[model samples]
Target: MAVTASGVFRRTAIERADQRVSWERTDQAFFSSGACHVLAWTCRDFYPDQGIALAALYLGDFEHPLHVYARWGRWVFDASGWNLESELLQANSDFEGLPVREVETIRTDLREFCEKHVHRQPHQYWADPTERARAYVARYNPPWL
Candidate 1:
């Protein structure tokens, strides 16, 4: 079923992921490098404190909460606070709507953040993304990220 952006469909991850992947990739799927995954989406905002991220995919899409990764083999709120798909952070999901220019800022900021964290190491592995990611996820989650 087709869904209007503002309706209940926005709250469902499956539907949302489908739309996001279609929109961004235009079916290109440049980032889907693994055979084990099924979907991906852009981020509108991320809550490291809550371990969750809000999605904003496709211009027609809206921001809403979605699961990032699991913790202790169970789904928990420990989000990674960043979406590689979007290459940005949704700093405030509560914002019902924001301009594209503002959203673009998120991408820029994210790149800067990654650079800061990745400097001073071979192959640019300065900060442990897995460990730092846990700062946004459950404590007991696998450290193998």
Candidate 2:
């Protein structure tokens, strides 16, 4: 699904100092990549009260290290410490109402696509450290920040 600029989704506020430090560390890792290929999709939640799920994959360094992030309702789940495949399947099933088999298929397709198409360096804006920082700030700066 296309990401909208409607301002409906806002970054969750960091209430504790530890959370702030952790977020900064994660953000640093995310932006440290010389290049990254991103794949994102939005799916309807099976539980209507939970709203929608926004899922994204960040591929870098030929997939030696990949990252997955999914937002369901107000919670953001990461594949940092959990089992990646199981986490992905669970998220897809819980948020998208997709069957296990279909989620597997989607995962395979995404992997193939990344393997085939993400060989080159990222755009200049992403490649340049200064530009990347500017872009990040522009994209994520909210009133609360």
Candidate 3:
């Protein structure tokens, strides 16, 4: 997996595929994980080098938006030319004003980081993003997610 000049995700599977295959692969992942898992995975994949901000984001509850966002902006700063401001920017997207693309990107990067550094083929899609997120909180949080 590699990041493009525009800081866009260039996955190994994505880069090798022809247009149709690429679309199919991405679309498949999207449906299986929902759009949010993509973002969570991004954070999980990238930033494995370790940082408090991202850790908090991964462990932090959804009620607090800043934890995930601060790390995203930090990655944007580290990577350069990233529009980190979009961390929470909501646009009129498919899910009725869903602005999750940026977070998805972050999750993707984080996942890549984990794979490259830790060599863990961690699965992001655990049936549901919300359930998975709750599980994450459960495991990482003090008592329950």
Candidate 4:
């Protein structure tokens, strides 16, 4: 089966959540095993050339989740995960509003961004504190760091 944009989104979400979990474990000295998962879609209006991306992130577990929606002009997060409604879907075309060719472009760009930059690489860090510190020093830090 071919991998879809939704699949890439889900996997990327999980990987991000897992990194958070690892950090939390290191800080709190407790371990919990679970990953974040996501459901995502895009919304577009060709006439206006406007678009939005929406996603729900099941953080660590499915019991509670975070909702995110973003467009060129706005970005929002709903911790309660209560805002999703049928009306929103209808208004946005369920992300099928853009031309068919644009769908592939969006998917490819998203996947590449997530894989290349957003997702953490294990080799970027080290188990030994000294080595980790040295690695950090050697690396070119981005603004986010």
Who wins the lDDT comparison? 2
> Alpha-carbon error at 21 in model 1, in Å?
30
Off by over 4 Å in 2: 1-78, 102-112, 115-125, 128-145
**Total clashing pairs for each candidate:** 7, 0, 20, 1
RMSD values, in order shown: 17.3, 16.0, 14.0, 16.5
Decide which is better by lDDT, 2 or 4: 2
Q: Scored by CA lDDT, what does every candidate get?
A: 0.25, 0.32, 0.31, 0.26
- C-alpha positional error of residue 22 in candidate 2 after TM-score superposition, expressed in Å: 19
Cα lDDT tens digits for candidate 3, 87-107: 323211222323333232333
* lDDT agreement of model 1 with the native: 0.25
Which order, best to worst by TM-score? 3, 2, 4, 1
- Name the top TM-score candidate: 3
Q: For residues 1-145, what per-residue lDDT tens digits would candidate 4 score against the true structure?
A: 1111221222234444455434333210111111111112212221134354433333223232222222233232111121233332232233334222211113333344345334223332222122332232233221122
| Ranking of candidates on lDDT, top first | 2, 3, 4, 1
Model 2, range 44-96, lDDT digits (tens) per residue? 22123544244433222223333233344334333121123454445434443
Instruction: Give the per-residue lDDT of model 1 (tens digit) for 1-145.
Output: 1111222122245423453342332111211111001111121122234333222222324342221222221222222222233222232222334423322211233344335433112123222233333232333233235
Weakest lDDT window of 10 consecutive positions for candidate 1: 30-39
Residue-level lDDT for 140 in candidate 1: 29
